[model samples]
Target: MENSKSWVIDPLHSEVLFKIKHLAISTVTGSFRKFDGTIITEKSDFNNAKVSFSIDVKSIDTNQSQRDEHLQNDDFFSSDLYPKINFESTSFTNVSGKNYKMSGNLTMKGVTKNVELDVEYGGSEYSAQGQLKHGFEITGIIDRKQFGVAWNIPIRSGILGLGEDIKLIANIQVSELA
Candidate 1:
C-alpha cells in the first residue's frame, strides 16, 4: 500500500438517507445520523479506490420516535443484535466521465450481500481551512429481505405494510489525511 493516499469521511459534511414505500402507497424517508468510512487510493482520479464504511444502527431516525424505536427492534434492524451496517468495496470502476460503479459487500443484521451502487464524483476542493476534500453522491437499491429485514404485514388488496426494496442515497465528503 505504498504511495497510497488515505481519506476519512467528514461526518459534519456527509449524510446517509434511505427511502421506502409504506403501505404500498406513501414513501417513508429516514437517515443514519452516525456513520464513518475511509477511502484509500493511489491516484487522485480515485479509480480502484478501496472503501470501507459503517453505519450505527442505533442512530436510525425516521423523525417519529415510536416508529424509530420499532425499527430498532426485531421487526427491522434488530439493532441490539446487529449494531452496525458495514460495507467494503470490491471494485470502484469509472463508468463514464464522472460516473462510476461501486460494487461492494453490504452486511446488516447478520446477513451479507453483494451490492452495486452508482456514484457521481463531484471532484475535489480545498476548504477555507485548507483541508483537501472530495465529494461524491452515491445511490443504490437493496431488498430489505436480503439483509434479514423481512418484517411486513398485509394491508388488504395485496398491499404490504412496507416495501421490500429500499433506496439508499448518500452525499459524502471525505478529507485527505496527511
Candidate 2:
C-alpha cells in the first residue's frame, strides 16, 4: 500500500552539503552540485514512509579546483572507482514533534553502513507554477573511516589533515508527479 503521492526530486532546488574539521582549527565545507533521487511515500503510516537518495561522488566542490581534483583521486573519495554514494531506508520512527528518526543503509566506497537521519517535514503546498511541492530537511553524520576513507596526514601540533567525522546536510524539494 503506497501513499499514492509520487514525488520527483528537483535537483535545481536541492542541495547536498557536508562539513568537516580541517586540522582541528578550521572547518571545511563543500557540496555536490549534481545529484538526484526520488521519494516514494507509503501511507500505511506516516512513520512507515520510505526514503532513499544518491549522490555523485565526482561532483564534489569545495570551491577549490585543486582540492576537488585531489578528492577525486585515490587519496580521498576515489571517484573513479566508486562513482556514487547511496542510501536506502529500512525503517522509520517518530521521535517527537515534527521530528522523525530514519534508519537506512549508506553505501560509499563500496562499504555499506547503517546510518540514521533526523528528518523534519516542512509541509507541502502548490507552487506558483501550479505544481505541488514537498519540502524536507535532513541532517546526519558519518564517520569517514567507516567507509574506508582513512587517508590523512598527522601534524606535529596533534591535528590531523582530515577529520574523521563528516557532517551531512540536505535540503530537498520534491514536485508531485501527476
Top candidate, metric TM-score: 1
CA lDDT scores, all candidates in order: 0.96, 0.86
Q: Once superposed on the true structure, which residue ranges of model 2 sit more than 4 Å away at CA?
A: 1-3, 44-46
Q: Which pairs of residues collide in model 1?
A: none
* TM-score against truth, every candidate: 0.97, 0.93
- Poorest 10 consecutive residues by lDDT, candidate 1: 1-10
RMSD (Å) per prediction: 1.2, 1.7
lDDT of 2 by residue, 51-160 (tens): 77889999999999999999888878889999999988898777886788889999999999999889887777888899988787889999999999889999867778
Model 2 poorest ten-residue lDDT run: 40-49
Query: How close to the true structure is residue 164 of candidate 1, measured as C-alpha lDDT?
Result: 98
